[model samples]
Target: MDVPRGFSAIESSAEIVNMPLSMCCDWQGFTYTMSGWHYLCEMLREYKLKPKNNYRKSILKKYYDKYQPYSTFECFLCEEEYDPLRHSTPWVPLPWESAFRIRLSDNQHFGPNSNTFIRKEFVRTISLYHRLESQGYQPQENKDGYIRGHFLKKGDDYRFKVSGGQHRMAALGVLGQKDLHVKIQPDWKRVIDIQHIHHWEHVKNGTYSEEAARKIFNFYFETTGIEKAKKYGLL
Candidate 1:
């Protein structure tokens, strides 16, 4: 299948839009803790480094133990383990993973078992949370700088998916900001009426079948988008 690219690379063509925090979600369309905002908020509130580390470890261990067996590979760049089974719920790999596939694959240092890797990731998340909280959200002067995302529309309803600046979004969420200004590409209002946006997370988390996911993907994305999904054995 040749899935046509839905997101644009040119940043100048993008526009900023204000959306409610309740309608915002991570790249995979998950909100709150599943979207990782809760964890980021917890780290921001905890002053003691040891407690933060413990908290991070516990969270990672819980998810890792449950999902690691299904993960085909883990990417430290985003501090996520990629399980084709879960990610390919809709028969397409997450856009960021597809874009950074080479870098992610080459940068797999010490798998999930290494404490050093865990500690480094924990520290990185904490640093990002603190930096955004203290310095405030500064939109980078690049395509990847802003809180970039896209709107998934289903009839009259819409949801914003944060494709970039996830940590910054989480920080802002903790700071009690209800309205978010998100940078979106020219093709931002892509219709995805195959299903409700809230059901997307359920699809990614393995609650939905691949058959259903394929139906959704075929409805929303073009044939060209599945090349990466095929490469990841998602087909």
Candidate 2:
């Protein structure tokens, strides 16, 4: 994946842990695989996140399909969403995790007792995560010394999508972590219900066209430019 400009794997101060929602009931699982990562600029501000194009090929799409299977995340339909994973440059591999790179992408599904199929890139990246953890590394903290995500309310269902820290979240999962700390995305539901219209609440009008629906989203957040994106965007 391609990383953003000035993107670097620096220390995150949030003492947050993001885990899979499937840990609860009514979710699916798979054979555990390591995890993956890409260097990116630190999220200096708070706002919602989205992909630029190819929603069909986005990891965020994968996340939504996995977690918020029933609910409709209309905002995600924004064609202007930026795919952070799309512009990443793989950092040099660390040690231990790199050793297991050969075990990636087990297409045979032969691995056992895991939630995901281990892949080389994930093996290497998660290995770095653990390596840093071994050195007493900690997750960047929110204002409460904990980092988390916003949950979008779709009808009666609530969906929490990972914006910036997808790699870290997956790493913690493979390492068998629990007690992930996150807060709801502030104003998310309100933003969804803009214009006092349920239909306009999200981009669920059978398609996504940011140009046509920018007001619904842009009213509460910024679009997809660097300087303006972070003002209303999330990680």
| Model number with the top TM-score | 1
Per-candidate count of clashing residue pairs (backbone under 3 Å):
6, 41
Model 1 error, position 140 (Å): 6.0
TM-score of 2: 0.31
Q: Indicate the residue-level lDDT of 144 in model 1.
A: 59
> Model 2: per-residue lDDT, tens digit, 198-230?
354223441323344443333223222222222
lDDT of each: 0.45, 0.29
Q: For every model shown, what is its TM-score relative to the native structure? A: 0.53, 0.31
- The local lDDT score (0 to 100) that residue 177 gets in candidate 1 is 69
Compose the digit string of candidate 1's lDDT tens values, residues 147-209.
Answer: 877765544455666667666766676666666556674444433434543355445565445
**Per-residue lDDT of 20 in model 1:** 67
For candidate 1, report its TM-score.
0.53
